[model samples]
Target: MAESKPSAPRFAYKGSRLKPLRAFCQVARLGSVSRAAEALYLSQPAVTLQLQALERELGVRLFERSGRRLAPTREGQLLYDMARPLVEGLDGLATNFREQVRGLDAGELNVAAGSSTILYLLPGIVEAFRERHPDVRLTLHNVTGAGGLDLLRSDAVDLAVGSMLDVPADLGYTPVYRFEPMLITPPDHPLAQKRELELADLSPYGLILPPKRLTTYRLVDLVFQQNRVPYTVALEVGGWEVIKQYVAMGLGISIVTAICLTDADRQRLAARSLARWFPPRSYGVVMRKGKFLSAQARAFVELIQPERSAPRDAYASGPSER
Candidate 1:
């Protein structure tokens, strides 16, 4: 009789199977290894090692590299299908354990958002969320509007807060707030002489603005186009705050979100609403579709309201002291 080759040992289908499968699934779902590593608190190589080991254990290639992404091969899809329940059951089991041990207060949440969010609105919401769930770990990362969207798509952030200027269709947006763009002008500027101004009225002054590609800029552009108004854009800055400073120093008058006006800003500068309705700009929460939110995030969700709940300038008085 020919000697039989050594066979790989079969696992009993419970514990070890879970962790690797869970990590592997997250890595695939997120389409990023570094993000998965951060989620699991493992080094990048450690996550890669788990994926490599998983493929070797199955005796079939589970992944094929396509550019920077690791996509499931035909065989990989089958394995993932087989592994889904096992991973889900483990997640449920963990949830149950935490509920029993920590009384439903334990969990983790991550948010990535624009820099203005850190200063403007996130502090109160985060504080309230933590007061209710002291056991949960909350983390926030500041990114620019464009960069924040990229981070959300990559699963680097579970939640994103920014201007909904021209969000992609793939995202699910909940309007947290809305505000009108105010004409930001120095106290003595002639544009400040008007109590309310129309788009066409800005022709006399140089203008500073966000890049035309920004959603706010796009909205401003649309307003001017709709009304057949002509105005000169002189300086293009990066953020609303920068535009405000240049305008305050009289470099140029800028159309800016009203929330940017702190008490000091309000003293040196004057703002006016458009004579005709300019499209209102909104800042909101953006999250991905089909991804399940954490419990803490779910609680935070309860606090966001549609644009109708509060107009943009309303909060410049300061957020409801909740």
Candidate 2:
């Protein structure tokens, strides 16, 4: 046989490609080789070599020096966005796999919800979840819609349970429950006495509403504006309880979702369907687009939507908003 060139070293291409990609992601995230090295528990030279090898393999200049710090180039940023999640997933693979195998025996689940959802909608589901998975540390974060989305995006909460009128491109919203819009006032208020109400009937009264930024406020405003019925907001408040209290005290009449209408609330306030004008609001799970649900999170979600039947509190109010 002709003289054969010495085969390349056996170990040259044997190692996993994940090492360099992991190093690249760390350096991109920290913006400094030394910091990335410390985070990865590797030497600075090793990190530098990894980055160099990654750039050489991809044939791209991954970073450019910005003063004393490193910043990713356009291609670098694109790569970073794609690689970051993968690296994180792989890094947590061991723990996630163990949790998957162990089921809900031991794990933690963090959920975000608005006040109304937490107080009314989640009570039964939460109780059931606790009963089933007591050992699986469960925490429900009380946050508004925007705050909940922020928590979900940052991985601070595994999922969010709330209403979303507008879903973002990078997130997923699956609405599993619906609640009618209701016009609420003190039982003896003029509007409450009418057998049948019209949208124009609400025009003369000042409304108690959440801030103009909230969905409820915007929806109410849109309906009145569309029908050319002029209305005023007497107070811009935050929570459903506070709004209901203000309305019951005759501060102003308000429009609310049935989700907050309980038996106790009905005795204090008269609630009539405003569903004729505004659409029913849908509430359910909100999660990051590509998030990985652990065993604990999956179990909690199952409780929210059981296969046998809806939870006791799924429909918070009775047949009528009366």
Candidate 3:
């Protein structure tokens, strides 16, 4: 009888093995199997199976279930620390390699920003980018300031463009545009007639401000508090456009960044420059420290700030305050 052929190993090495590793890293980062599934665009059972397969292959319990959350074990943390960068590198390899060869002819770029930044800041930059690289896919994530930072930290976005009064330690911000604060009032309001205004001048009017959770509202509150002026919030709303509309309707005046002001707004409402009272706000590109920017993302950043591309330094050197 002929010798029996040796059977193949039960878990042979294949490109598909990377799937479980990717799923594991996502679950480790997000701390939830469902979230990892959503992020990976897989079913919950599929992700669960991948985790189980990974655990079996490694012969270790990677995570312990704590109610609805999955907490990584020591081995899991060790694997994650080793696997995350590898996974990120592998996942980005194609894009990076293409960018290296084609030099921005094609690739995908994801950017995140708050509503105001998307509405007021990115139109011209995006138009120029799209015209320049029509083949490259562009996705804009409309997120809040905190959400944008989260996306940046997780490498979900190539970069973020928005205002930042306080940047975190691990992020870099380069100011690309500056806009002064402006006080907006109905055409017939009392403060509209004043040639010059002060913080005390805004105290009595009912302020139609964005919710206190927003940076703009916080800045306004801080400025007033510093100046020892009392202000009233008649309504807490979202969006600069809505506040502008309400101000035009004589609901209450608002303090808003001048970036949103347009000729139509000038016609409908009285506007006063608040540069003397409040410092000019800067809108800029925010990125994670040490992130490797693909050519497509670099090209977009250059479009926004022609003076510079993504910095090569480990982190931004000094305070980003303007």
Candidate 4:
């Protein structure tokens, strides 16, 4: 057997350079070494020395002094803008940890989620959250897959959870869960009597679904087109809960995911496997190309992470999707 070699020594990023980098960034943002020193609670000479070291390290003049006014050199502006967020983020993370220890942490994870996730998955996530991070506030916003991406681009939401119909050039996705679409029918419906239903089986009954604006419609349509099945849509409604309620009222045959039904919900309706071909609906994590998610947002994501057994049904919206 081969023996493992000792790991190489790693360098610390906070080594002698953090003070200089912090001072240089602050001076650039404030455009005055005196102001930067005051803000940092340091002597002006001390701040100036740190800035000098930063300038020496990069071999560039960071700022130009013009009698009572200081302006960043072109290079200084670039460096400061890039470093500002990094240093601020680190500081924020530290403060958050300290607050957690003192029972005074207050923060929200701005999350965009699909209606189904808001309905079914979030409750478990929120319930377990009290045990793990009691002080962190969780703010969830409802967004369609496409709409969620817009929030991410606009920096409205820190992270997005749902099915993305369009994977834009400036976006990314992670498959957190996978669910298969199934046929939903009233308990008394003829199709409800079947053990397994197929896409070809849908031709006999009218369809009930949300409007085309919803991504589920696209997945359903794609399945119909792929399998060359002839099916006419009967009702195009809004909201999955409304659709399910209508199905319970014997509106029409509907299609939904298995996760959407619990034992109680199942009593009101019948769920059958779609023997017909359809792509698996994957719930995903969507985010902007280069956005930094908040610490709470990241932790929530880890907790709600899909297991091997993906849920297939939904309920009414939670605090997330409005």
Candidate 5:
């Protein structure tokens, strides 16, 4: 009989492929090889090679180029969904395991929040956390709504603190603060002098609003549409501070969360409560469903919501207790 050819290995060791899997997941999360490379602290060529190796090993193209962005293909999405949790668990295992043993003495905590939350809400909480656990490394990622959710989904952030008008099915939000909506105008603006303000009163003056993609803009649009009030947008700005600056310069009035209206802002602009026209915005902590919290993250959450940090059994007894 002719000599039989040796068969190729049917499976490779899982340990050997972990590096490529991590590279693939990072690329998927960041949507670009270069960005992923920067995030992973690796060379772009190295990341590219790892991605190619992963694709070859799996016999599939994981990502597709879409308008200057690398979007995950269906197979890529599936692989990411399956591989992310495993990768995160393995990567975090050492730190979390040590934290569980050492009782929160050392660990890393990553949090995501928008400008408003970081500026108005987090100073005291961050101070308290630093005082309590100075050894723990804490990083605050300044991200907007969609970006915050993206970080939460990719396990980049332990939790996010922000306002959510709509909550996703796979996330849990715990409200920690509530702030009213306010309409702000320059001191000499016509609306500022009105004795009784109405939604229609805003129609004559131009408005400075955040980007249309933001929840604040959508809420403003919905409220105006519902009330049959017409408004004009003079400019679409990004940050509350920038919007305030424009408003103070007589460019346009703006609707802002009361959290952002400090005493300094009150001196330059006139702020009137719009509680009757708009709902109070709730700022909260958001986390992915079933995500395991590290000791350090749990401690921070407790500091943010001390009243809810009661004994576990107290919460387990009934919905009322919870």
Candidate 6:
């Protein structure tokens, strides 16, 4: 019999599986073949071929078109939920390995935080981290809650530090600090003079608040709605500093978190605790569930939570409150 060419093995090598898996993960994550191709530095057709091969090999449809985006099918999501971390770990193998050998002397740390957290909470922490590992590069992304969550989901940032009222299933949150809710007004405002602050007392003055889409505005609305107290917003603004400034200028009163309240702020703005009505806001580390934290990332997390470094399967164990 003529020597039969052994049927080419399905995959060229065991390692070849990593490539398709990586391609699948990128497409699933970004929901766009072109974007995934750009991220992977592969041609659009190359990415499409890899995804097609993967589906064929696996005998399952991986994606469905939804509007302009590629939405993962149930099987695709199941695969993605399992494959992303593996691909991420492998993609970062070089960096992680180098960090292990060098002991955090180099490598980059990316963190996402809101402006308030960046300004108030992280200055001391960032200073401490830089002093210890000056050689390590640190990049801080100033983003709002939704923006930060998107970064976390995409693994563009190693971790996020912020307040969390609701923890998603795919992510873990460990609250390290708590700040009381405060109502602020101009120093001479009548509401500031009251010894006892009532939720209903501030109904008369229009509230200056962040956009209604933000957690603070929604939380304030929730509390008021629950109490059946009607309120109005005089100005919908963004940023704690701007809101405080507006409140100081006697434009309107605002409900704010105490994290943004400084001595200078107290000098310019009258602030009273509204904690009795609103739950204390908790600020902490937010990370994707199955993420493989690089050494540089772990070192930063340790600085934030001195007692314990991030747990490997933190989301599985549920959110921890410190």
* CA lDDT, every model vs. true structure: 0.71, 0.82, 0.81, 0.72, 0.81, 0.81
Best by TM-score: 4
**Candidate 5: tens digits of C-alpha lDDT, residues 1-322:** 9999977543243436777788889999989999999988999998888888778777889999998889999999999999999999899989868767565777789999887677766777898899989989999999987898999999999999877878999999998666677889999888889899889999988889988998889999999999999999989988888998999999989988776766677679988888899887777789999998888888888887533321132111111100
Q: Name the regions of candidate 4 deviating beyond 4 angstroms.
A: 1-105, 193-198, 305-322
Cα lDDT tens digits for candidate 3, 128-152? 8998999889999999868889999
lDDT of 2 by residue, 1-322 (tens): 8999965433222265788889889889889999999999999999888887777667799999999899999999999999989999999999978869686887788999887778877878888888888888888999986888899989999999888888999999887776778889999999999988999988899999988777888888889999999998889999889999999898999998877776777578988887788888887788999888988888887776523223243324321111
User: Each prediction's Cα RMSD?
Assistant: 13.1, 8.9, 14.5, 7.0, 15.1, 13.2
Best-to-worst order by TM-score is 4, 2, 6, 3, 5, 1
lDDT (10s digit) by residue, model 6, range 127-187? 8889888998999998976899999999899999987888989999888866677778898
Runs in model 2 deviating more than 4 A are 1-96, 306-322
Over the full model, what C-alpha lDDT does candidate 6 score relative to the true structure?
A: 0.81
TM-scores for all predictions:
0.64, 0.69, 0.66, 0.70, 0.65, 0.66
Clashing pairs in 3: none
Evaluation by lDDT, superior candidate among 4 and 6: 6
Winner by TM-score between candidate 3 and candidate 2: 2
Error of 6 at 266 (Å): 2.6
Candidate 1, residues 162-254, lDDT tens digits: the string is: 666555888888765656556778989987886656566787787897777665567667777777878788988776677777887889987
Worst lDDT run of 10 residues, candidate 5, spans 313-322
